[model samples]
Target: MLTFEEKLTIIESFPELTRNDISLGRVNFHFEESVKDKKVVVYRLHPNGNGFVYAGEIENSDYVTDSKGMVNIRDFTEKELRDVIQQSIASLSESETVTETWINNEGQTLKLIETSGVWNIYAGDDLDATHATYHAAADYLYQEGFRLL
Candidate 1:
């Protein structure tokens, strides 16, 4: 389980969450201390590696969900998610690494890697779809500041 401070640190590190009044990836992250609260933080992400606003949440030590109804973190096991979140925050606060691998047109495997930043991957050969997925992943990662790796 992550403390409120840890969660807040992660949320604040995200530019999407911290800047701009009408940001697409903005999320309202807060905690109510008086009672045990389940906080929901909404953001955008591509469902099929395309572009979309996919809401998600990190709640009370045990439950995380995405807008696509995909439950990445659930029950009491969500502590691992929290840990990932913390790692992401720490990475962004300093520097982070990201790597991507995919097949190119020659039926040969290609790898596009980026360090101290984020990178996206696409499965198909459509350039437009691939570009969209890359942008979507960048936006999602910028907003959430976390990924499954």
Candidate 2:
């Protein structure tokens, strides 16, 4: 495991991340432009380092309010930390929702989702109903009172 100072040096290398030293010898990194507004904290030496990177608004995840779907970065190497930080910041700019959606004049909505190598459709955010192909998903949507828009 890298020492706190070593970690700090590596973290400081990223100019986009502003540093803020918190209590108990811990450090927090801030990305002001991030949609998921939260300080990325890398802890002092601990078995389960509180260090984490925000992963945006993911539901059904372990992250609580203080962490907007933060993923733990415990005992990370230089490469690992850099990669996680990059990905976390990147995630802030991306749509967290996994499905693509569209609505009709009547306000009824449809969604096309791709997961686990299969295409699926939903009335709104989602519904498990998997379709075999993109064409199949499109057909399902067409049959459900939706049109290409």
Among the numbered candidates, top TM-score falls to: 2
lDDT by residue (89-114, candidate 2, tens digit) is 44454343445675667977776766
Candidate 1: tens digits of C-alpha lDDT, residues 76-107 = 12334334343223223333333554443445
Q: Which residue window of length 10 is worst by lDDT in model 2?
A: 41-50
Using lDDT as the measure, the top candidate is 2
C-alpha-based local distance difference test score of model 2: 0.58
Instruction: Give TM-scores for every candidate, taking all chains together and pairing residue i with residue i.
Output: 0.26, 0.47
lDDT of residue 38 for candidate 1: 31
Cα lDDT of model 1 overall?
0.33
